[model samples]
Target: MRIMLDIGHPKDVNVFKNVILSLQEMGHTVKIFVRAKESTKRMLDDAGFEYEVCPYYKSMAGKAFGILANDLRLYMIARKFKPDVFVSPGSPYSAHVSSLMRKPHLAFSDTEIAGLVTMLTLPFTDKIYTSTSFYLDLGPKQERFKGYYELAYLHPKYFKPNKSVLDKYGLEEGYILLRLSALSSHHDLHASGFDFETEDELRDYISSLEKYGRVIISSEKLDWDTIKEYQLDLDPDDLHDIINYASICLSEGATMASEAAVLGIPSIYVSNTERGYLNELETEYDLVYNIPDRGEALEKTISFLQNKNTKDEWQSKKVVMLNHNIDVCNFIIDRIINIDKRGL
Candidate 1:
């Protein structure tokens, strides 16, 4: 099978990297397509994957225009490559192109997309996949699966971590890892509330923890002042290494919280925003503690540290995840092949 993989969000590039190798190993001819937004070029370069850049912007407004442009872009790529399937993590633009080609469209989404977005694209995307065990009835056309939040394709099992990353960051022992995000782009206005205003309120709370340990604040969008004051040394490509070795993981982002859980590290997710994946993890996987609000983050952090029950529960849960886990690359490709056979 020939496959065209499109990455809408630059952050999802690691997943593209993982899926590309898996498809190639499965003997499929694979071509790459991604939006040229943010540090998208950097993501492609960091993963050592080469591709044709579409003249599409990453923002919502730009992507609406980029959709028409992507149709042209994907149309040209499809004419040259003639792939069997069009695959993405459910980008609205990718769905537009795949629908036009009458090819099976396989999109790997997580539990983060809003219902409105899913409803808008459900008609075009043939198979919409999520890692969550929850019933993903975004619409009648969508298909959800029990998977994970970690871009597992970039797992240490597949992509070896370079210790030089630690060297690059000059990270020694006794450092705390903090991941902060508003998740506003995800369309979950009511879930959590750790925005710049809320993050500022919690900033001193975290700094107070710094007295007990060193703190490194990581973000997708951060002010220069915070970065300078935190004095964080981080390599953009190899953050899991830092999370894996950290004494504690604190975040408002669902994916990083899940990553910390998968890595067996103590995780505190600030639940001031929409409770999508974090709600699932707390309910299904005993991986991390979900604080009701930022007000509880400090108390939860201390409770998680002092409670052996939390540690033991997570250990037990990790073993179960190991049993239930699927090689996402294999699983996704197998499904694609079957769908192709069905001529969807």
Candidate 2:
């Protein structure tokens, strides 16, 4: 079967890499259409995947216009490629294009609060897959999976830690991995993230972590003047390696926090946005601490770091979580093939 997969973010690329390979091995022709946003295209290049770049616009009006342009572009490309089905990580463009092409559209989303995209895409999508912990309803079109969207790629069967990455980066033991996202995405319009207004609070968080170990800051927007020496600089693919070996992970990004949790790393997630994925990781897995503000995040970080059995406890919880959840890649492949074969 011919398949068209849309790559909207680096996270989407990661989620579908193994799925694409498996599909190709099964003699399926797969065409990837990706957005040229951040390091998404770079990672696709590094992975040696053939893809066409879709332009991104920064301004609201530009983005709105770009959506129409991209929709038409995707429709034209899919018309030429003649794919049997279309898939993406909750992309409205894919939904629109597939609708025009009269092809089935399958979308996967873990975020319950992506209101704009959900409203625009779900009506056109043939099927919507979401985590069982997802807090929203999509009527009869929604299918619930026991595992997270991250498990599609990051499950232990597919990913192995590269300890050599530690030596290559000259990373010290017990370093805290810090990720600061741009928070400028459409869904993040009114979201609160990493209270940076009070520089003292930010400094205090770093200083407190410094006492336990080195603080490695990875910021998408601003560099911390005080921790300039510890800024992370490396290939985007090597990030998981560093994350696996880190003593702790703190991020304003939902994806990073969930990634850390699945890797059995203790994570302190700071954001006003509440995700069912993170909530399940926190309540059931006990691997992530989701705090609403910087003050509470600092307190939780200290508590997590101070616990001597943090790593062991989280790893044990990870084992239990893995035992209960299905291998997500197998599920994805099975469903895609089943749909294509049955013409469902």
- Alpha-carbon local distance difference test for all models: 0.68, 0.85
lDDT of 1 by residue, 5-43 (tens): 887665577666666776777787888887765467787
Looking at model 1, residue 240 earns an lDDT score of 70
lDDT of each residue in 1-344, candidate 2, tens digit only: 99899877788888888999999999998899988786888888888899977898766677688889999889888889998889888899999988887889998887787888799899899999888989898899899999987888779898988888888888865789888888877777777778686656678778887888888987776555644556767789898888888888999999999998998899888889989989988898788989878777777887878889988988898898888788888888887878957555
Clashing pairs in 1: 131-147, 191-273, 191-274, 192-272, 192-273, 192-274, 193-272, 193-273
lDDT of 1: 0.68
Q: Which pairs, if any, clash in model 2?
A: none
TM-score of each: 0.86, 0.96
The Cα error of candidate 1 at residue 278, in Å, is 2.7
For candidate 2, report its TM-score.
Answer: 0.96
